[model samples]
Target: MTTPRPAAPSPTDALPGGLGRRFSWRGRQIAWTAFGDGPPLVFCHGTPWSSWLWAPYARALSAQFTVHLWDMPGYGASSMLPEHDVDLGVQGEAFAALLAHWGDGWGEAPHVVAHDYGGAVSLRAALLHDARYASLCLVDVVALRPWGSPFFRLVRDHAPVFGRLPPAVHRGALEAYVGTASHRGLRDDELEALVVPWLGDAGQAAFYRQIAQADERYTAELEPLLGDLDVPTRVLWGEQDTWIPADRAGRLSAALGHAEARLIPDAGHLIQLDAPVALATELRGWLAEVGAGRR
Candidate 1:
């Protein structure tokens, strides 16, 4: 029941829109993509997913904004250093480097759309690195204390064991775990996109390594600073989210003082996949409200 090593990804399979590019950061190759023209909007994907998660949405928003997407170090086409820990803190640094890479091309402060663990990474980059963003939209984020699902706890506790599971076992576990993120169940293509990266030897090891490195300490460090956000922020949640619970959105909104929390009914943690049209509409409206579109 050993999992065979996956062949190298074809150029077209490397990234959505055939736009995948690579850069060296912290001795690792970071993969990213940018498209469209106009003000920049960066999309940060959650755990077990990559920039591919935002492909459709990025295309939707490209008409009005230059959409950027990236796979955090351990996910997608990015380098997965088994010896190094790619925790929230490290992700924040990588994000900062990305901002620098975008430089003046990103205009005055890019807008951010982050989901799941991406919310944690974005928050750390904002608070710790002083990364400037015109506005931010957090969806089904892991930004508060008492976070992590029962399964997340299990993985954190036995990451090494899970990492060493037979390939088929790992694949089954991955598919099942990701399925819970959406209430409507994942489509075959969607599931394959999310699961393919975790199928190979390096990908399999990186999957568990990421879980093992999950630490609330980084989020804890930003909790106190949440209330001090100086940019426009909106908290969006999937009403039926079973992973992080929708109520956390209220807490996040309260922390942001002026930000409002909105819920998309009939959607789950993976709102991008469940209700992409609604998510894109909400984001467009928010950007307009914050005058991000004008920039």
Candidate 2:
């Protein structure tokens, strides 16, 4: 069962301006891109999502800071072979490696903006891998315990069975699963951008492979170490997040050493799309602190 290496996609193949480059991490070519010249800022996305999640924000903030984004090895526009390890612990190490790979790009500890499971990865990178950040903003992140929707639990227990589903059936399930993330339904094109990575033979298998590999122990291990981090932090959640209830926001902020937790109204788990304007305002305000500190 050899998985042939697929051709790499054009850097700007999907998201406008895209994460237009690659970084080799543990033998996997991770897709990434960066822009601007102000203080550096990096974005880390969560499960079932990719660098596209930050494309628009990257473009808007590029005018103020060098914004960097990348797709995890088993995620969008990156390697998705069945054998690739795409779990949280590995992802954290990869993120740490990705940052180090950039060398002087992080001469100054960069600001980090993370969403969902990306939060866990960034935290691990900092706690275990010695990755430093000027500041951290966690948006509807996956950090607390007892996560995983019923579907996630089902798939986690039987990923191989689900991975073997007919392509059409898998597509429908993916669409429906993703739909739950937004309070307002996503546009067809929007949904396509998020779902496209999990289509076809390789993508479908990779999709379930990631779900199967998802384990909360990665975050649990870092929980007690939360307050040990001295980095400035902000926590945000969509008021209507059905996937990870909004109630977890305050606890997470508290665990992060009295950090602020603000909930955005009318948005669900996918705050970037559900409430872009508000999310942007919050992010800009949060990042502004970093700018002020250096001045």
Candidate 3:
């Protein structure tokens, strides 16, 4: 794989800031966008998308809480993980590093909000290092059960071949990458921006490697950790999500101890993008309740 360009200067490197900064943990570099100014609330974006995915909701969330949206290791503005350690455990450790950096001023766990692959990565962190999260909000996340879609099956069979392909072809692949159970379908701009970075040979290779290994190296050990999680948790879903199957909500709801499962009627796998208004409303309410109890 071609070496990744050094992460563009930290968000702090330029621009008078309200929502951008960078942090270096261990030897890894992470880029983040922060909004609001209260106790920390971190958001983790999943595959192909970046922290920018949370912008629509941040408008409202920034009004009441400190919202920190991060570009997971390779997807957004964050630097690529060194070629040596890119598995799930390593990704979770990266998250833990960011959490520690974000929690420097706070005395307890910061509320963690995550979606899709982000949910998997965060759950791994919370499980391996207990007390790292005060509360969690999982949106359209993958649970322990294995229910492979035709797409997933394709990956299982063709990852090696897929990994070697030229990045130029990724432009055509974005449509499939962003497809979800939701009926709205991905808009042109959304699909383009999500896939732009991966259009290069190195980017495409890096992406395929991560996706192919996520389940085998990370999720298999991740599921068992859920039953032991004692943190306040909420699992929300897009009722229309077809990618991972909406039915899995009940299974996740039950497995997460006290986690409540909510369905956003017209939304799909990319719930926040499809129904940011509804997603934010639910998130705000959950945050309110958690805040109230703390008071």
Candidate 4:
């Protein structure tokens, strides 16, 4: 029997990363959370993941910066209806629109931290849509050309077929695929938290929808102009990131005008789970630079 889905989280409920509020953009509700009292720092997550990926770091950094996190329109606690355009193109616009929604903080430029495909979306917002930022941190991000794993390609080509799989089959594929992102392997709880969002029909269909819409052209449009980005940038990678391969970090750094490609040891693509402390130390340091009015 298909399990009846749980009630959608209300604003009063304790949620993952404590993201209990919503921001409506383009008729879609975007779930978000914020804390601390310093300059604004926004985090953007990539595919099959949500703001929960950054929850630990958000709290760790909360002491010094007002850390903000939100699920994209079709991810996390946000809307995932069939009518919503959750592709990178629309994601970019939604991101820029969210920034506008937070325009009261404009006196201080927000620092944007993006992971995976989020790198492309944030770049599109900053470069094309004219969203400003104090700095940017691209961590295990999908920005350069030739991205998308073979599995990603498979799903992109056959999303409808895969989406129709029996629940057991889809869950199996989801576990196997998402597990590969972290070299150290996830604890039972971590794995469950990540997997639970894509369990039911809405989540399952949205999962395939995003994969089918994953296109290299999104980053392609921003590559030539990477050097023109005026904000300070930091490119970070996991030493053992087999998914994107650590080598791509160097190329991305060079493309961003020689920003150093900092690698965290004993981690993979999902550094947030594999090496939280190391990543946090790096962020605290870099964000310290960003916070000190060092442009």
Please write out the lDDT profile of model 3 over residues 1-295, one tens digit for every residue: 8855333333222212523577876665677767676677788877656766776665566656676777766665666653645556776888877787768777767888888777778988888854377789998886555744677667656878877765556545645766553367766556555555565666676667666665554677866668888889988889988776677777887877788888888898888768877887899898887772232
Q: lDDT (CA) for every model shown?
A: 0.85, 0.87, 0.70, 0.85
lDDT of 1 by residue, 216-255 (tens): 9989898999988888899999999999999999999998
Higher-lDDT candidate among 1 and 4?
Answer: 1
Residue 47's lDDT in candidate 3: 66
Model 2 lDDT at residue 171 = 93
Candidate 3 residue spans exceeding 4 A from truth: 1-20, 180-182, 292-295
Count clashing pairs, candidate 4.
0
RMSD of each: 3.2, 5.1, 5.5, 3.6
Alpha-carbon shift of residue 144 in model 4 (angstroms): 0.5
lDDT of 3 at 244: 69
TM-score of each: 0.93, 0.93, 0.85, 0.92
Candidate 3's TM-score reads 0.85
Cα lDDT of model 3 overall?
0.70
Most accurate candidate by lDDT: 2
| Backbone clashes in model 3 | 3
Residues 110-172, model 4: lDDT tens digits = 998999978898999999999999899999998888888889899999999999999989999
> Residue 205 in candidate 1 has what lDDT?
97
